[model samples]
Target: MPTAASSPKNEITIVGAGIVGLATAFHLLAEGHRVRLVERGGVAEGASFGNAGAFAFSDILPLASPGMLRKAPKWLIDPLGPLTIPPRYLPQITPWLVRFWRASLPDRYRASLTAQGGLMRFAATATQAMVAQADLAGHIRADGNLQLYESEAELAAAQPGWEARAREGIEFEHVRGERLAELQPGLSPRFVAGTFTPHWQTVSDPYHYALALFRAVMARGAGLVHGEVTGVEADSRGVRLRLADGQVLNAGRVVIAGGAWSRPLARSLGDFIPLETERGYNTTLPPGAFDLRRQLTFGGHGFVVTPLSTGIRVGGAVELGGLKAPPNFRRADAMLTKAARFLPGLRTEGGRQWMGFRPSLPDSLPVIGRSTASPAAFYAFGHGHLGLTQSAATGKLIADLVAGRRPPIPLEPFRPDRF
Candidate 1:
């Protein structure tokens, strides 16, 4: 346990200011708990800000689904593939890769879906409520999303997964041939089919949403500190967060939501969670040239091109390289190249390129509960690609667990010790 008496001032200290951390602060503040949030960088500037902006309730499949392992090798060879494993870093990534491969087994993949789908469903409602409560609904759009395919072959190959979606109660409207073009006229002539998910939604500006959450927490008088949490010390009374700046904050409980940087901090608490980062890239195109009716996904390619309030944004590419590796913005450029092929009229007159790491676990399911070894220490990170979609629900669960209350969603499925 950590002692509140151990600090100069008693407060709950949450490490990392990504969406997850900020969301946790919002929930804790709503419960009238004093909170101290420490961030090494600006909120949402990490992986959260660069996401495709899709709140995909219909996307319940894990990344380790069957048959994906066979495709991984070819993707790694292509510099512009949606998924890539750098040759130099392959040795370091081998173990994680093996674990991920094992997770691709039929039994494990279904289990992951059951866990992810249930959590994401709760996340949908929690996210909506948070936006409304924080008055941040201005940034959100609840209209659905579309995943378009370029060929009949692609559609047929994906039908099994879509069928599984139906069994999981995920509703989808299949659009093919002329019907697909009718829904979105701007699509390329090459598009043959698509799936319309009425439950999918998006945010206009993820950065603004993150800032709103941060401000909401601050308005409640919670301290938002700028520093890195280096270590944690626990005793009979409570937990103490050791900041890099030499300042210490004590809390009756602690939640680690450090995004891609969570693994090391998690280890300090005795949970060596096998967490990794999937660095993703994005690019923004100027307005007039790229006018998409809704967010569009290249089903076979796994990237998305969305028409935004500012401009058209193209993003997606999973790089297994670690967090510190230099960003290869070429990946974003490649995405732009692919986007142009899908939308003939799209043009990029010099756009901003960005890269960020989504904290990922082997099975794509986030680590989202109390540590078995350290009950006082909780984990709410490793949301991977679904951080933006899942943050609010994760925060609510963490808050409920810290207060010794039962979470509306089950926790054991995402327990830190599940590995």
Candidate 2:
């Protein structure tokens, strides 16, 4: 089953140890291949650690979808708004944002949504399979996710969108007033109507899931290195990873899944990936009287509040801050304050904040295929806010690409050089 030639000792080096990298290593090991996963920091301790944890099935809209460009200026003005661009970093990322604005055209938007939707559907199944194989069912919760809206007018206006999604086979049911209370008694009565995507799921802790994957892969005898890969050297025979410490590790193929920090690593291999970090924030509260049964997304606030087994967790926002900058925890605190408006009983004062990067491209679709620049290198980053939803499927696609097998989905839409 191994694809690394006839020698079992051949190393298949993976450049990042986030969800995508670890999952790819898992799949490769499943196929009897030896792998070495190298991370810049601790495993899964990057952006993958503090995600909102929603296993979204209908998060079909791309970040560059229509109607976002006009709202950008306003969203940037309001500090409490869903999207923000820090004044200091504007000069550096403006070009990328301009390209992103252009990609928001209807044609590109539709294509991105379709491709991401298909990948997300396949990812849901792959997630189930991998989790079951690792026996991590305890960390997974099957409670369907609810998207709440306070205004009936807004809900009515969004009908066409929901109907289109339904036509695409995304299961959902409408909930209003009393029905909303019946389904989630903790929600504020101000939320007049909402939609419940019964197919969606959530993980109690993303770190726990990553830990599970790490343990499973290590148990199967894969190797892991704690270092940053500064460069990737590719040739006809294979690829070699150049680490920060100047050590080289050879592999038949290399996967770039370094999240927001992927652009530079990708560039070192001669690919120009116009990627930016959509920095997201999260707040974790100590256990209190507030208990929630399902994941909650406030349409008005543009954030999600999920009931973590430890305490309540709130995370959202798209700040154009680079990956290495210090995190502004105020955004996460703002999320808690915003959550209080939706659930009157929810406390806003007693939680700590965290921030991490979400790798984003001008177009919402991620780069998930072989590179035209380098035959032995592969690209799988840029999932935006849907990294968790897209990770598993991306891994399977990478495995199929390396094995030279037909991918489950067409690869043209996600070509690395579409720029």
Estimated TM-score for each candidate: 0.95, 0.95
For candidate 1, lDDT tens digit of each residue in 146-200?
A: 8887778888888988898888788889998677776678787788789888788
Segments in model 1 whose C-alpha atoms lie over 4 Å from true places: 1-10
C-alpha positional error of residue 360 in candidate 2 after TM-score superposition, expressed in Å: 0.9
lDDT of 2 by residue, 113-166 (tens): 788778877888888888888777898888888888878887886786787687
Clashing residue pairs in all predictions, respectively, total 6, 0
Against the true structure, candidate 2 reaches a TM-score of 0.95
lDDT for 223 in candidate 1 is: 81
Q: What is the lDDT of residue 366 in candidate 2?
A: 83
lDDT of 1: 0.84
User: What's the lDDT for residue 202 in model 2?
Assistant: 88
